[model samples]
Target chain A: MSKDKWNDEEIGHWLKSVPKPEDNRSRDDILARLKADPRLRDKQPSRSRKWIPAGVAAAALLAAGILIPSLMDGGGEVSVSDSASESADDAAQTTSESFQSGRSIEQNSAASDEEMSLRSDQSVMEKGLMGAAVYPEAMEGFVPFRIGLVHEATVVPVTFLIPESVVAEDFGSVSPGDAELYNRYASQIDEEALGFDDYHPYQGTVSTDKGGVTLVLSGDHPYDTASASITTFAESVQETFRNEENVLVRDESGAPAEFDQVGALPEIATEPEGVYFAYEKNDGTTVLAPDRRFDPAHAAEAIELMKSRTTDLFEPLIPAEADLIVELPAEGDRMTIRFEEPFDFSRMDDQDAARMIDGIALTAAQYHLRVRLQNAVNPPAGYQLEDVLPLPAGPNGIILSLPG
Target chain B: MDESVFHRIYEEYHQDVYRFLIYLTKDRMLSEDLLHEVYVRVLKSFGNFQGKSSERTWLFSIARNVAFDHFRRSSVRRKRTDESFDWETEQPADRGLTPEEAAVHGDDMDRLFKVLDDCTEDQRMVLIMRFLQELSIAETAEVLGWTEAKVKTTQHRAVKKARELLEGMDGWGGGGR
Candidate 1:
């Protein structure tokens, strides 16, 4: 079986020997999936049945093979025009193609599917960014502005993509830096609209120089009301400007600002530690937070712990219905998650599934590991199933204030 | 749209496209996802598929685009994060199977499969389309959005590369020891 070179005939023989695996789904199963795809729901015949409004929390549901056509409002790797799935892939596309023409289901007798490419199921919407995390694959032509927004007790890091068009129109040609992001749009956010309490447009000028970020607070700033208030402010600052090593808080005179409880603040190190779990509040704000009492021995433990509630406050990222088998490589940074067969990911709420995937990736990052998901019904966008995927740029993805 | 027409077109071509995607992505789950996408797009734009080309060829082209789009997005993301990772130049561990997998698929098949994974994307695609899926040079060109000459050239190189690597393997019996 050894030779300096094999012949073409032999190569063809071997190539022909390569196995052809059959899709396990029946035609009925496939048709059901196609019909249930909220992305294609308009093309479906109107029947006296429940139809999930496209992208109504259905962003990442197109790995859809089993769910009866429900609703779609979230984005995953599955894009649905611009108004379709709020997927990272959609966000990465040229910023003008919106796919909200489902109402007409126009007779494009002359238009070919090639016209839209295969991007129908994967566009970024202004609505819900399905899982709200920037997989490494998101934002190619766009710049990502990642910042931590304060939500009462937690610091939530979210990403906004600034399209090139906006960059060109607003800043001439060059993309602006992350430091400028907070200054430009921090005050513009209606924190309550984004499910966070009113916090931004901090009562100060934040400048990042070689000495680190300098917070020149206006005298009337109420950050010194109590110890808890100062702590929240410090944590928010730390989370927001995690890139800088030292943060200095000063009064308008540029001297160290004093609080009644903590006195003058020292030069702060910008570091946020520990992993996060999806926590839902009584008011319905579901953000990622770390349990004050729960700490794991390692990343594997953290990932396992994240599957279920660590406390009453924290909800699991991975759903209870998925009886997934996770295999951590004894060495190396790749984790393998094998799902039990007959699992239809589209059946779960898109937001839940997305958070679960992001939560797993974020947890794996605690040990510098990337997850390689296996045997998923429809693994959402922001994941490359064959490759070990890195964690999303940040959690709670938002496209707020695409600065122009 | 009548479901029967879709069923017929699907019955004929879904397996071939699925096989092609499996060969291209080398992951069953991913292939399934891409397969769904292909049909989803196909069904949505089915009215416009005017038989300008044969249904098989059109379907193959759609399938190729679906696969290509997936790869392009993935590679684009990688390039952003890891400066050194260039999709055009990256040799991959796409289908490297474990001992259990090799035993299940047979050592020779697994070896060939793994070796094929290392081939350049163009060459690998040409070889799979030309030989395994049995698309002609013309159809392969159409699917790849390339010319027939490029298809022939890539098919030749893909086969040569695979053969050259296999000659050095221990149990490959194709070259007539």
Candidate 2:
């Protein structure tokens, strides 16, 4: 459109002229597809009926746990334990009653839906715990202490949740080796007390710095080799110190290791839940590992951090060399990713490309956002997404099999 | 929605949805597939449709999602040995002349689309919605889930970029005017 300066009116006129191909298919084709969609079928009654009892059963099981504590404490008002047990019992009773009444069909259906949603949430959490070999014997009374992985410049923290029994008052008074030993024992209890499946003693040195803690790991294996345990310990030590600015994980030489190193002291703060990292295992299966500190709110920023390839466990699907530029929608549920020159995907084999896309998609999916690749080269067969790119469903579809 | 209601919606909006997908994908075959997927989603989720947005806006939003899903799924599929695959290859020859060629053949509309391909996806989306779809800034923002300011800024930038691209083309002299 010709104008002194191009305007919206002219642009609109020009755009309207773009050829819109004819749709030869009749309305019958669409009606046929709609009919074929099983989701539109009349299966709600059966599905809703199945979940009602399941919800009741779950609530009863929870009530059973509550009953145990009250029964153990016995009947005495003066006993603090007895009062705590009574309150737990009351809460459980309320929950059970709520599940029992299905006054209206709509209300019943809604309750059933809530139960199904809760079950799905539990499954996701269990999947998130896939790689972790939890030592329930040691962790019985321990509460999760979350430590933020603060990126110094932006003060954006990725929090890691660690289980701990007691918080240490002083790290300065103890030797580095002693502090490590004390923290490990305090968190996991005495080695002799631990069951066979409990995690082993620390194989790393811990030292305190100015408002920060430094971990000098001695093991030959990378941090990711025992990612769940190593990260759990790192989080615990950070939690123990009150003035921790950052937690630094280091090699023996005292220099920052390329992967999962450079721990500063703690600046312990909690963010809203739903923090996750996309990490690939040795077996090549990529899994979404949830962290209390990995905030999804800073997903755009977190995605940029992933590009640095900082963690041993997590790798960026988009190659490190690629110049990634992202545009996040104002609502924050969708993102547009553009890669500049040297971001070639044409040379990658099908598996590598799929892995790359999976990493990007899984990370974005954690935040409930879909990603569109703006300038991706060599998209897979049957896909031509130079424009209007959409993310596929995340690989969370694969059922996570926990390590035996 | 019931089949009869869905049939009415299909009759009312299918052409617009199909056209939008065609513009976004530049592949008629793929756009056709996405059009069906969009309706399938619409059919499944119709009960949840609160009428908070216009039917047209909702349909376009669904179309956009369907197209993106197509890109994602296609990217993950095992590679085929299509030696003919080339990133720079012009729009399929069977699809008829590209906008640039159409512009040379005295089609002003094609010329605009040719210039549009040079803009970023966000810019292009804003331009298409605001101009060709003739959606108001508020409507465009609503459909895109972007702020009105974002829509305005993106529209401004898109026009500037398209002007630059057009200026560079041979025999360009405000053909639309």
Candidate 3:
């Protein structure tokens, strides 16, 4: 009864007195309603239907990568008497040649420059090929054409290829005007390359305005590639549509993205390049190597990859047993690395600590990121980094350095 | 969910769900409508019930979301109307209470509901789940997607506010019934 404070017992007693309505509906009425209720039907199966288009788009893109090169080579016109099997063989041959040229350039570049080269030999291979004017006439307006380097591997080079026929009907479904544009672009493409091919390059709609050519990369094209690949793809697209003063690239969501040229793209690093993992040299000095499989663009992902015990090829400098929690700032490019428990460096010598710092700093630097160590006791001399410490130029500073 | 299993669940928890919705919305017809919707959603998502929480807590959580959705829809409707609507002034269904029955129980019960309606939605939910439904702090937290500490804090605040509201009532100054 006290007004100042009411306990749970008093509150319960008062709430128990609140009146409620009696259920007047018959069991039959409830059952009937339940049977008719649409939500009660199996809806989970329908949820997966949304992903079908994406799967189709991915398949179409893969097919385009194989078929587009040959189609472009033949000038987009196929002979009516040519068997489907023969056309398939030609496409397979073109794909092989393109891949071979890419590999040869990569091998030549690696041999020429011992340092890791930012620009792969794919650019040289592209230069050898005819310009974007080689885009077949069948694909001009009907298909979305994007020419860029694809980053499928650390050292391997692949060209960006689009398969536009997969979603041409979807574009044409939008309006008659879009159909007209598709025809105009289709006619404008280099039709002499391949005859009326089933697959055309370009996945989304392409339109040119007073500003420049805008290519909306629609459906499932290029989103699965690395950040570097997306940038390369955009650059290639810009190169192909070079006459336009500006080339605006939009993702499937219709949001304008500059990849990494002017702004950051959404974390599209399905496979990013230049991931660093710690390895030890013969002299017991720890070194870092760019791990191709595990490219971590952020500090937390990098720390997780680091925590995975290394194989014989690489060694971990940070104590494998130490649980590190990393917090990345939302607005700025700073990362804070905190240990689950206070990290004791008294057991570690200064050189070992310095090696760990180098490994951490170089891993962050791969993403153009920075790190701040929290609750690190006895960090190495001149390396007690507090907040927002700039990453070292390279990892394993004593034994190895990054290429300038 | 299998039809037989779904029927059994509906039979077991429908009343409790109906009561909770009534407490939340105060309108019996709206509560009944939302109760049906809650069960419909439960049937659709029953396979995803990972058994991390008790069936009762999960059902109450669904009920809470359905009630909030109703509130959102009604608020949008209310925006179009010229006249203002006051929750305190809206009378709940009498359920055929006689003049004599009303005279005996209506005043204090009405006042209690009015005070409850005055509380913030989060505070009201915490108080109702913790006290009226006799859910534990952990259960309340799970249902509301909140921390146990947050549940305790909101419960404390809600009780304090209810006491203040009761004390302000005419001729009801710190005295038991």
lDDT of 3 by residue, A182-299 (tens): 4343332221121111112356767766654566767566432323333334433433443345556677676865443225442222222334555432222233454443434456
TM-score result, candidate 2: 0.40
By descending lDDT, how would the candidates be arranged?
1, 3, 2
For candidate 1, what is the lDDT?
0.58
Model 1 residue A70 CA deviation (Å) reads 18
Predicted candidate 1 versus true structure: per-residue lDDT over A179-272, tens digit per residue: 5767865665544434454577678898876777788889988676533346557767766776677688898887898887557875555644
> Relative to the true interface, what fraction of contacts does candidate 2 keep?
0.38
lDDT of 1 by residue, B1-177 (tens): 457667887878888888887776666656776787777667756776787788888888878766765564455434434645455566545324434333334455566566677688788888778888898888888777789988888887887788767875644454542
Worst 10 residues of 3 chain A by lDDT: A123-132
Per-residue alpha-carbon lDDT of candidate 2 for residues B1-177, written as tens digits (9 for 90 to 100): 478768778778888788777667665555666676677667756776799999888888888766654443233221122323222332233345545334333355456557666777788798778776778999899888889999999988988887677666634553434
DockQ for candidate 2: 0.16
**CA displacement after TM-score superposition, residue A276 of candidate 2 (Å):** 5.4
| Maximum-DockQ candidate | 1
TM-score, prediction 1: 0.44
Per-residue lDDT for B1-177 in model 3, tens only? 367766777688877787687676665555666776676667756776799999999889888876764453344234334445333343223233335224323555566566776787778887789776779999999999889999989988888887767657633555545
| Cα lDDT over the full model 3 | 0.49
DockQ of each model vs. true complex: 0.21, 0.16, 0.14
What is the DockQ of the complex in model 1? 0.21
Instruction: lDDT for model 2, please.
Output: 0.46
